[model samples]
Target: MLNLAKIGHFFLHLWRGVRELSGDDAYVQYLKHHAAFHANAVDVAPALSRKAFFKLWQDSQWKDVRRCC
Candidate 1:
């Protein structure tokens, strides 16, 4: 089981990687929006837990955007 601190660190790293790869604040904002949307959906639907939602979103094609270069 992952601790809260470890989970936080993992997310921080993910955000940093996304920011670095995209090199655009807009993409980061979009990613956050998608994450929030999925989070809310899972909250409202007990059948969909946060972990499962996050995993699904992480592998979702919607989360993939071309790098700005």
Candidate 2:
């Protein structure tokens, strides 16, 4: 049982590390920020959907990078 527990903990950290390195946390962070913004704003805007967030993120990531090799 102890070994099993340790294995589970290891996998959990591995999953988190992979998500962080792969940008999977971007949408989650965005939602957190959006909630905080809305909490402090008098007229809050609706949060973007996941698909919209991913599209915007991808666009912003490559908008200024040159593809020429």
Maximum-lDDT candidate: 2
Candidate with best TM-score? 2
Q: Write the per-residue lDDT of candidate 2 for residues 1-69, one digit (tens) a residue.
A: 479988999999999999978889989989998998788787777899999999999888887864878
Estimated TM-score per prediction? 0.33, 0.70
Q: What's the lDDT for all of these models?
A: 0.62, 0.89
List of clashing residue pairs for candidate 2: none
lDDT of 1 by residue, 1-69 (tens): 769999999999998888767643444454666667777564453334555655664577366673667
